[model samples]
Target: MNSASMHPSDTNVGMMLVISAPSGTGKSTLIRRLTTEFNAFTFSVSCTTRAPRPGEVDGREYHFLTREEFLRRREEKYFAEWAEVHGNLYGTPRQTTMDLLALGRDVIFDIDVQGARQIKSNMGQGCYVFVFPPSRDALEKRLTGRGTDSEETIIRRLAAARHEIADSQWFDHWVINDELDSAYQELRAIYLAEKTRPAYRASWQAALSRQWGVS
Candidate 1:
């Protein structure tokens, strides 16, 4: 789609977006699928201290950091949002995200509930969505089915999910991932719908004027 055809303020094609979820809710899977399908999105890279899982690349999966490295950067106020997940710290570097958005490219953030809220508040305006599992049981099964976490970890995640779900109402939109393909379709629809919101009309008009040479 051409810029002139969109809202004047509507930078829909190139905007930072936060996709949040509790653990094992398929946020990563969904993001992977999107990155495969869309060329405009750059998955916002997050820094973390956790060891990489099998087949996960360092720069692609996360910017794996040492405890000292994370702390040093943390003290420098470099992150837009940071949090500790099971003793490992993770964060989104602020400048990288802003740089991407300034270039009119979409930065996709895959983060937990806490960091998501911080990014939304700090970024001021951007697309924020909570990815919900079909059901609690499904979440539990997915987590364990991977066999990556211990039972204790699973329970802790479930407890955390209870709080996350409570906060979903606070976000702009929600996508219940009962089925993966359907959820992706819904997410795509939401993106298009956002472009048409009244707030975006001025931008669309400006773009059109520029295109048609209307003073």
Candidate 2:
């Protein structure tokens, strides 16, 4: 059906896309390319009690908050999902996400397994994708090649990655980042397909109803 033929309200159906992956799976790069190539996609900025990294701006990368403020907001249930990672508290703002969805903007989340689980429990609708490296050896090479972590830290992260990948079985889709271009194409395909699902396009049902004179 031609979306242009439908009324604004009828065609304005939004979606949420959640993506999670192991630390060295290059998940961030895939998400970056998707958001860059799609104008309709909005990356959800999370709230965090951690200090902003150099060159990170407020409300862009994260909504930086004090520890006390983060806790207060948590208590008020302002976050859809909140988790403490590596001693810092991070959360997705509940109202902001809902408002974006109501406006027909597809929101993309770059979160971890813990955050993904919370989001699944709280909001049952959304396409969840998990990215994986081709092999554990590749993941270790990627992590070690970065030269940012100590050997001990790298070992710990590898163990964490195994657990994260195990939990990924529940995700709707999985993209193996063996080749960057191929992996990105698969990821984009998932997003495009999900967008076309009848459940996500309310206008299809409305248009059909009008044609059948069901109202």
CA-lDDT, candidates in order: 0.81, 0.89
Tens-place lDDT digits, model 2, residues 152-187: 999999999999988988999999999999999999
What candidate 1 gets wrong by more than 4 Å, as runs, is 1-13, 48-76, 86-88, 195-206, 210-215
Q: What's the TM for model 1?
A: 0.76
lDDT tens digits by residue: candidate 1, 90-205? 88888888887666677888877788788877777678889999999999999899999999999999999999999888888899998999999888777667655544344565
How high a TM-score does candidate 2 get? 0.89
Q: Residue 124's C-alpha lDDT in candidate 2?
A: 73
Give each model a TM-score: 0.76, 0.89
Best by lDDT: 2
**Which parts of model 2 have CA positions greater than 4 angstroms off?**
1-3, 6-10, 52-57
Model 2, global lDDT: 0.89
The best candidate in terms of TM-score: 2
